[model samples]
Target: MRFPGKVERHAGRARDCGRHFTKTLRRAALAATCASVVALTGCDDKQQVAAAGPPPAVAVTVMTIASHGAAAQIDLSGRVEPIRTAEVRARVDGIVQKLLYTEGTDVNAGAPLFAIDDSDYRAQLEQANAMLQRALAVQTNAQSVVARFRPLVQRQAVSAQEYEAAVSAQGQAQASVADARAAVTLAKLRLERCVVRAPIAGRVGRALVTEGALVSAASATLLAQINQLSPIFATFPKSNTAILDLMDEARQGGLQLSKDIRFPVQITLANGRAYDETGEVDFADLSIDPATGAQSVRARFQNADRVLLPGQFVTGRFRIGERQDAVLVPSRAVALNAGGASVYVVGADDIAHLRQVVLGDQQQGQWEVRSGLATGERVIVDGWQKIAPEQRVRAVEQHGPGPGP
Candidate 1:
């Protein structure tokens, strides 16, 4: 524990120098570690910044909402009817001999439809002719006697009473011939009526009487029914309110139809399909039904193909007015919910905006927008689910079904 002073001082200096060197080495190592940790933190922040980028734009097919100004269309329930209907009846009293036309077939006017038993009529005609011939022969003989008696009476060779009797007999025979000729004419007319013919050119229904059935002429017998197929009629009962509304529309210039112009009409079948044939508004009843509070409207449709039959239920449509500068969109574009109909309209900046629209009558695959849309505006039709409201989008122009309203 005890040492010289110089030796003790040198030992203390050596220990101090060793401690200081160790402390200096530790500080240098700590500084190097902190520098490496700071460099790693800077690299991590750059990686995160590179991973985060702006959202991609959604793509969609859009149709510009344009004003297809057309006459306003009103659809109403109706039924198909025949243009003309006639009841085929027996014209002469006789037994039904033959049915000339097949049941439910087309027949021309004046074409023979039924054949009645003409045996009696034929015999009566023959009898009248025979009687006329007999009367003519008698008249000729009486006339010859009268000619011979005329000279005898003047010359006093025969008695005047005998000559006068011969002249009276000739007159009686001549009168008999005239009556017989008139009877023959009547018999010929009766025989011609034995063959019943069609009264009009149309489709005939089932035959009421079979062959060998007795038909009376005095009673207009029902034989069959005929209906005109081509140019059929469709009658629709329109409510009084609707009629008044149309009149109001006309007064406001919503509808500008000509006085003599027959508005174009269309029909839809029960299967939700447009009828192949188009019709025209032909008649509109002025008087309203007190019981139903509706007016009857009629339309004429060309049924050359006979696709539409009488009594068939249909939806008749006609132009009640027009919509100027109206917005029209595809049927598929609009979406429905409890809040009513709405559509996704793409803006000029390629942003999708959800908009509510008022739906009107549906046209050819397009909906007539009453409000909430303007002309030349882009409405998304195809890609609705691609984005939500306020999301960016890529719009593309498309020529879709919205051609006419």
Candidate 2:
């Protein structure tokens, strides 16, 4: 017969085992359901992505590129300079007595600019004049003696040695007179220099020396500066490499500069405004500067309003030459990166293809494509950023002169 405690313990043991098994089953069922839901979500996401299909064709504005005779222009950094400049300085030693001109005003060539102490100069000039008069009196008396001796020597009335001596004395007196005359001329020049004058017509700066200030001719003391503002010069440097390339291109008959060789230039001031006057390249250095490896170029512009100033920074656009059968595209259409300059070309299949282009001069907001593009090719100028290379695009012809010529 079984004991009552033992049978109850066995039954409790069996009930605990059944409860543990039920918990295990419920946990496994919940985990399986969560896994199934995650798998279905992943399948739906992939199907949605697949159903979306290829990306929609990007809409872009394109231009059908064709050859046109466009003016070739190159922009270079430049500085505005006066066509003529002069330094007003003391030419004779004296104390500055008066400033004859109004500072910062325009003056004509040889206009009086300053007045230096003239009392000493005048005294020296008078002394020279007195000396010259004395020498002249002596020369006249010696000439009369020579005239008497010349006739006496021929007539043998006087000793020949005495007549010869008298002739020599006249020549010495004449030479002394000439020497005095030279002294007088020098004195007059020195006196004139006491009144300083403008050496050139230009706008003069402030006087460096005031009244009573001593200036030295030996040191060439600077008194003021003047610069011609009208018909000013815009000086710039052109790259030596560019010059060489241009020469080569010219030799190959691929480019033609202006017939007169005076390249037309346009100036842009520091304020980002175009100058009213156009200029021409008047001078170019014969050789490249060794330090900078650039050729110095000068352009002259009529600055009637005195807008261009000396040493002012500016930009110069040089119309160097023209190219035939050239391809051009809007500047904005080209993208520059580490790889190089490239543009989006829309193929006949309506697919945008990235094309590498060799660019020449950029004129009027348009780039001259030297290579990598041909006539009849459509280049995407607008909405190019939205598409990738070889991607289909809906090209619409751009209206108006979008960027420039």
- Tell me each candidate's RMSD, in Å, in order: 13.1, 4.2
- Tens digit per residue, CA lDDT, model 1, 1-405: 866998999999999999999999999999999999999999998888778876778789888866767657888999989999889888789999899988888999998889999999999999999999999999999999999988888899989999989989999999999999999999998899898888888999889999989999899789898999898999999899977777776787656545654778989998899888778988989899999999999999889888888899999888755766556788889998999999998888888999998998888778888789987789998889778899998888887444542
Candidate 2 stretches with Cα past 4 Å from truth are 1-17, 38-55, 129-185, 239-241, 270-272, 287-294, 399-401
Cα lDDT listed for each candidate: 0.87, 0.89
Off by over 4 Å in 1: 1-68, 130-182, 336-340, 345-356, 372-379, 386-405
Give the range of the ten consecutive residues with the poorest summed lDDT in model 1: 252-261
Model number with the top lDDT: 2
| Candidate 2 Cα deviation (angstroms), residue 240 | 4.6
